[model samples]
Target: MKKLLSILTLSLFVFTSCNDVIDIEQPGTLLAENAFKTVEDLQLGVSGIYNRLDNTTQIRFNSVYTDELAIGDDSGGQNVTQYSLFLTPTSGMAATLWNGSYITLNQINKILVAAESIPVATGEQADYNNAIAELKAIRAYIHFMLTTYFTTDYTDDSALGVIALSTIPGLNEDLPRNTNGEVFAMIDADLTAAAAGLSNQSSRTFISRDFITALRARMAAYRGQYTAADGYAATLMANYSIANQTQFFNMWSDTDDTEIIFELERNVGDTYDRQATGGGGWAGSLFAFVNSTASGSPFMEMSRSLYNQLDAVAGDVRLARYIDPSSTISATPTTSTDDYLVTRKYPGHQSQPLMNDIKLFRTAEMLFIRAEAAADANNLGGAATYIKQLRDARFGAAQPLPTYASQQEAFAAILAERRLELAFEGHRWVDIKRLGARANVSIDRDPIDCTVFNACSLSNSDHRFTMPIPLGAIDVDAALVQNPGY
Candidate 1:
């Protein structure tokens, strides 16, 4: 583990030193090929992949383009394209997610190519296999992300997905879109390989076998393969323990928390200044304005309806932990209420206040995925059981078990719970998309709060809900078609 940390520490220097020159398309593949001739080189490639896990573009895009948050009055007119749903093919966030994820993929491919014929030490063969599996899993994860944002339908096998390639293509190559299911198939194959080689190791930052399981559970749920998702999530629940109520809040502040499956670690002395102004760790910076007064405001605020759920969750531990609940901003919305409540959910920082170790997967999310899957499979009791377990952990043991007379009610309850549980962590927008694709649920934005931001309510079928393929990608590859209503 210390070796992994040291490798990351050194590679971060490489990332920062060439910060100005790391073009998303080229991504310095030449450097990777030149560097990776030995086992240590492979280790550095692993570190490189981990270091780029948390990106500012995807984080901001996912957070701002959700129903859980409304644009803050003091947003300084920044990121209005996402907030107002005026995203185009040329949007910055779209370009970032497109280029950034693919860059990581290219780096991973370089490592795999380098290791193909390299001699492995006799006893270290297992380690080499595991490292390769980890890279494949990471590759699958990146592909899934692109599909999640680019594809219109999560369950539609024939739906257009991003440019899917196992190996790095030529710089001038024009790649066509892969079907959503085709992309998922690739992800599944990688995860299957990863699971075999990972050996169920427990590491919060690295891609352990259990982390692959968690990813499978999430992917299954996203794909509406509820039965399979339930099984995968059950395995994880049996293998790993959830953080207790007393430890839940503290978990966000430290990297050693047990609930984390995989996270992007941020160290104070790392080569990159993640805590500095305009740094990569802006997840907390988006909504966390803890020390601000009435005049100084947050970048985003919680939607009023979401806060109402938080308000009614009956002794919600997250209220004080995640939401301030009481704050006055001198703006259109005088006091923070349903429309403008600030969130501290993604304040998963350590070492420094501003730099947060970005959480990629957590046990709590898997449990929720399990509950939703159960509900989808018409196992309401099973759904309620997981939901009750999570609520008890969040709101306290005394909180009454919820009763649902119908599957629709159960679904609604689970959706509401997800909103409260996963707000500002980048799940709200996709949840809305999945629910919309599966059950035709519309996203009703706050009319009052979003009015000034030029934002309006979005229907389940709104074309803007799914991100448009970035124009930069199409400019390079004209075969790539733009999403509807872009």
Candidate 2:
């Protein structure tokens, strides 16, 4: 039997009193004071943090709100439209992302700070530190992601920043956001410490040295630190071989694989019961696919440009894995729509549904990073070799390696390939941000405003790129500044 990864659940303690009218207070339990005292306590705290992973699957109501997938066309509820607005960012999705990410950050910070204070009497000291390192790594990971969504560019290291919470919860203070440079410095420090503490461990399914290195390379590439990025990415690619086309899809089910550096696991008893169950609550419906409930509103559809780009490539196995035609559509405006293709990549069903794990870092991504870095460093031949490895895997035994006339062409091809291969995996927006090419594509608006989709032009100057700090958060601390334009 496969071991089920534990998900954390906690009880909230509240106090209420009746005054002249009535005053009620619901004070949240602190992980520092209440949890993380022993191995079991620490385990539960860690589980709580990892439970967020469920949000990435189709089972949770909030799963696909990010760039991963659009609200299916059939959804009419306010939540669906509110989520759709997030894709373009004129609506409140930006605030939600900012708030939700910070919430996770808070949990990580508490875990790290608390874990450090607990004295280890046995060999558990090392285990405690390892757990601390894991939490810290998760903190850095969340920050890296938050910065990508909230800031304009990784190169702008000097901008005024949001608070970098490294300690446990206390009195709210007005801490200035660190510069992008400062933020990356913190991320690197956390990851380096995590790597050192986590080394010599044999758990391949959890976050490991390779995972940290891959993320470091990803951050380096985003910062245009080409040589460092290439070096780290090269180490990863050379050690862990790329997954074959079939293995690429199959590895999602296996959980333990050379390709996945870290992932989130789901099972029967632990399964999300939203859409997977017949219930109509948040977890009850599959938002990525079109259904009778969604009407004609496909929340997210592939852009014509992306669709054509994939169609232009022959014998690419990835296109099939990433997209599937909707056989259930009917003919009226309500149905019979061929445009309603569903993403099968994240299908998590009861038996064989979406048991496929959520990939954190994989060997193929590292190879692409190395290719881009090598190209930027003017090592065209080296860049070409790496690019061919990835392309050939997708094209298989029949197709010949593509030829590029110039370094720029090879670079562009590599990027395009990343976009196609990594779509809906929470990567496209970051890639566009790092490249400073926000102006290149038009934004797709909600389906109700069909004209908005045609007219939504995006530019680097658009304020939408930087999300507004959450209203609730701002209300809590007057000193906390909102992102400019939000």
Candidate 3:
């Protein structure tokens, strides 16, 4: 593990400062020809690729930049600029998102290229094919994230999307951004090829057929294809059961995977053991310097608005699962420092503080997707039923089913439910960006939380909703067009 981390750390430094949009420099230890000589070698290479995948950047950007979190007492100007609605082409988060994703994509492309030349033995063919399928699945997922964050409009096919890199680019090749239509076409092709080669697997830590389904479900929902999203989500809902209160609590402790569909496993002394500023870090470290506690130097706390919403629920287990037990919740949090509201969502696992697995997909998200689809189709009652079904599991008892009079009301209810359910899992920002205008809502930080910077709200239609193309990439290639209003 130490040796692999050393190689990856060095490789990441090279990848981050490359002149090309997607550069490939071989790691010092493993050359492509010698890396994939056998099925075992291919499997090892895939594991290394998986190490490059982390959502800490998205989680941090979503929480601190949105209404999910507020500046904590321990803050020393960390993310203060972003929390103040200050984003630019040179913003650290933008550059991190662009460079980190392309790095992972390049790694996958490199492995795929090397695997093409491998000699498959009769008995090893299945393993070889499965390895390749997993690579394709991860590639498609990275591209999906890139498109979701970088593209200005998900509904417009002609809108600018990120560069689609299926193969490693030459050192001097400067790639231009592709259209949303082109990127989605590439994603669909990769997913289709992945689905054909993958087989059933029981592990939630690795890519399975269900992972592909979950990705399709999310992509469809983002693209506003309600029918397709509904079908994909329903298949997964039937396969995986939602977690009850006890199961949900255990899930945060890494004691259960009852509701999780896929997560990136983080182990002690692995590639992501330490603090990483942008992409690779413990998800908990994004909020706190040491751990998820008041004394642990938590630089960010759960927003009072979000906490109040959870507290309003009579018996919802998410409130306990999200906030630390040791926190001091003030009756009236008139200021950010009045209440600790320490976040305990990633309390840590395997006796490592703040190092839990990065959960990418869960059955709960699928339920939300179904609810959104129902609302979009004007099946208000059906949408309410799905939301109530989830609430019943969380409260560990039957709850009153909600009612919506209009389609916008149904959408508003669905988005509200999603905000609470998917709180710290990196969905809040994108949720509002895509569904906010439809639901007639946007970022509304509590008066108390935003008093420090006076950045209490952002309109749904604001151009800042779409992240700007990072200046680092643009500086490298002048021809690459930037997102509008950046």
Per lDDT, the best of the predicted structures is 3
User: What is the overall TM-score of model 1 with all chains considered together?
Assistant: 0.87
Output the lDDT of residue 260, model 3.
92
Number of the candidate with higher lDDT, 1 or 3: 3
lDDT of each: 0.69, 0.57, 0.85
Q: Which stretches of candidate 1 lie over 4 Å from their true place?
A: 1-14, 17-33, 275-279, 288-297, 329-340, 346-351, 437-440
lDDT, residue 456, model 2: 28
Candidate 1 lDDT, 177-237, residue by residue in tens: 8888788888888888887877447777788887787888888888888888888888888
Mind giving the per-residue lDDT tens digits that candidate 2 earns over 283-351? Answer: 223443323122423444444445456668677776676555542332223221334545555545345
Q: Per-residue CA lDDT of candidate 3, range 252-336, in tens?
A: 8999999899999988988788785765878888788888887899888999989998999678999988988878889976777
Give lDDT: candidate 2, residue 354.
38
Return the TM-score for each candidate structure: 0.87, 0.78, 0.93
Clashes of 1: 3
Clash count of each predicted structure? 3, 25, 0
Ranking by lDDT: 3, 1, 2
Higher-TM-score candidate among 2 and 3? 3
Best by TM-score: 3
TM-score of 2: 0.78
